[model samples]
Target: MASDSSFDIVSKIDRQEAENALNQARKEVEQRYDFKGTGASIEWSGDSVLIKANSEERAKAVLDVFQSKVIKRGISLKSLDSADPVASGKEYRIVTTLKEGISSEDAKKVSKLIRDEGPKSVKSQIQGDELRVQSKSRDDLQEVQRMLKAADLDVDLQFINYR
Candidate 1:
């Protein structure tokens, strides 16, 4: 009998890499001549990152620098959730949060995609924030991975623990 081949799908970010990117963004914001008098600053506030500047445009510019650093570090932009800058007293602030783990609703979407479009021999089960896929054929498993990667999902996915 052929043994089952399986893998788990998850959405996760490397905290160390994210922090490195944040540090780089902070350094650039502090040293840039234009930012010197703009009161631009970026820093971690609890579990979220805070970007502050004298105006909305300056705050957004700071966010752009942070995003560029994040991309250079090979982190997915989808892992970070940000919203429009808002006024806070005399300065504007943009708060960004690092996203990790697939929500239950998103997990369900992946499971449904597998059940509807994947090879009949393949099976999927949602385990908390991760989805597990199993099949008798390794090729089918690979095919499913390809399909998932091609799907336009909001969260970044990673496959792991294949056996």
Candidate 2:
């Protein structure tokens, strides 16, 4: 019998790369002429990112710079989920979510999606923040990947650790 080929389903971002990108963005914000006097700042805490600026436009500009840095560092733009700005005195703050791994709900959703829509040769099992999908033929796994990509759900997804 042929051995099953398997791969992990995940949405992992390299935290080190993200931090490096954040540092670069911070430097640009500090040195930029308009931002220098605007009291704008970007900070990351746990899975949340915060941006503060004197105005909503300034905050958006800072977010743009941050997005550019993230792109330069090879991070997917889909990882960010920014919220609308909230007022705080003369400044405004916006919070963004750095989505890394799947939650239990998302894992279950993925598992169900695969079982319902995947090829007959494919099978999937949820494992913590990831799902393991297996097939007797590598072609089935490739097809599964294509199907998932075509679905394009809100959460970022990546295929990894294929064996």
Candidate 3:
């Protein structure tokens, strides 16, 4: 039998880099003339970020700032998923989701996807936030990767650690 090739699927972020980007965004907000007096603020709690501003426009501008800063810092924009604006009086708040894990549902979906569409020699298992796929043939594993890339899972995917 041939040796099995395998890889782990994961959604992880470099917390240090993310923090650096956030800090830069805060500094820019403080120095930018338009954001001044707007009482705009950014809050980071656990895996989420909250942006608050006096108005919806300002809130969006803050999001743009964060996006630009993260991009400048070489972070993927896929790391942030922003929610719709919520109004509290004259202020608007938008919660930016920092995706860090693949949920059970997504994991199951990926596992099933691999089982259904993967090469006949490949097998997959859902392990918490990740899906492990393995096959006796390297070509089968490569084909699995190609199939996964074409699947619509609404999440960013990466193939790694193949042997």
Candidate 4:
């Protein structure tokens, strides 16, 4: 009998790439003519990214630049969650966070999808923030991956550890 083929589904970000993108954004903000006197800046504050500018529009603009850099680094925009600019004492701030891992609800959704629509030989199990999918036929596993990618899920998915 052939052993089952399996792979893991996860939502993950490359932290080093994220840091590089942040650095590039910060450099751009500092050197741009429009941001010269605006005091626009981007940096990490603990685990979150902080964007500060003299005005709300500038802060939002800085966030846009950062987002673009992140995209260039191949990270999904869905992984970055940013809030509306809020006025502080002397600056407008936009706080952004990197979201990783599939939530239980999202996992459940994926699990349900596999059960309902995937090949009958496939089975999926939720393993905390990730899911393991197994199938007797490797082609069926690939089909499931295609279906998940085409799904309009809120989280970004990555397939890993194929075996």
Candidate 5:
């Protein structure tokens, strides 16, 4: 009997790449003519990113710059969750946290999709923060990947450990 083929689906971010993007955004904010004297700044505050500016519009602009940089670095915007600008004394601040790992609920959603739409031979199991999919046919596994990619899921997914 032929062995089953399997792969794992996960959501993860590359921290170094995210940091590089933030640095690029900070440099642009420092050099931009419009940002002069605005006290605009972007920096890492512990595990999260902090954006501060003199006004709400400027703070949002700073966030836009950071998002553009991240996109240019090939990171999905979905993984970056940013809060609305909030007034803090004289400045407006926006805090953003990077999201990684598929939650158990999200894993269940993927498994459901596989059961409802994937080939009959395919099976999916939730394993902590990731989902493992197994099938007797490699072609079915590839189809599952394509189907998942086409689905409009909020979380960013990566396929790994295919065999």
Candidate 6:
């Protein structure tokens, strides 16, 4: 009897890496000449990230720096959900949240995609916030991974636990 080849699809972020990126962004904002008088700042507020500046443009720039740092840390930008800048008192603020986990709807969408377009031997099952894909052939599993990578899904996905 042949056991099926399988992998788990998950959306997750390393909190420590994210925090390092935030720290790098904050240091850059503090040292950058243009941001000297802009009062630009980036910090963690609870589980979310906060970017504040004297103007909307500056606040957005601060966000840009943070995003770049995140990218440098090998985190996908798709995982970041950043709000538009809003005026708060004397500063403009942008609140950004890191998205993790596959929601039921997202898992369903991926499952559907697999069933509709993936190899016939491939099977997908949604397990909580993750999806498990199994197939008789490893090649089929790889093909499914390629298909998912090509799809323009809103969530960032990672393939793990391949065996």
Q: Worst ten-residue run, lDDT, model 6?
A: 37-46
- Residues 21-95 of candidate 5: C-alpha lDDT, one tens digit per residue: 999999999999999999999999998999999999999999999999999999999899999999989999999
The ten-residue window of minimal lDDT in model 5 covers 101-110
Poorly placed runs, candidate 3 (over 4 Å)? none
* Model 5 stretches astray by more than 4 angstroms: none
The digit string of per-residue lDDT tens for model 4 on 1-163 reads 8999999999999999999999999999988999999888999999899999999889989999999999999999999999889998989999999999999999999999999988889999999999999998999999999999998988999999999
In model 5, what lDDT does residue 29 have?
Answer: 99
Each prediction's whole-model lDDT (CA): 0.95, 0.89, 0.85, 0.95, 0.96, 0.96
Instruction: State the displacement of the C-alpha of residue 140, model 3, in Å, after optimal TM-score superposition.
Output: 1.7
**Candidate 2 lDDT by residue in tens digits, 1-163:** 7899999999999989989989999899999999978989998866788899999999999999999999999998988888898889999998988888888897888788788898898999888888899999999899889988998676789899999
- 22-105: candidate 6 lDDT, tens digit per residue: 999999999999999888889889999999999999999999999999999999999999999999899999999999999999
User: What overall lDDT, based on C-alpha atoms, would model 1 receive against the true structure?
Assistant: 0.95
lDDT of 1 by residue, 1-163 (tens): 8899999999989999999999999999999998989999999999899999999999999999999999999899989999899997999999999999999999999999999999999999999889999999999999999999999999899999999
What residue pairs are clashing in model 3? none
Total backbone collisions for each predicted model = 0, 0, 0, 0, 0, 0
lDDT of 3: 0.85
Please list all clashing residue pairs in model 6, or write none if there are none.
none
**Between candidates 3 and 4, the lDDT winner:** 4
Better of 1 and 2 by TM-score: 1
Q: Return the TM-score for each candidate structure.
A: 0.97, 0.90, 0.86, 0.96, 0.97, 0.97
- The worst-scoring run of ten residues by lDDT in candidate 3 lies at 154-163
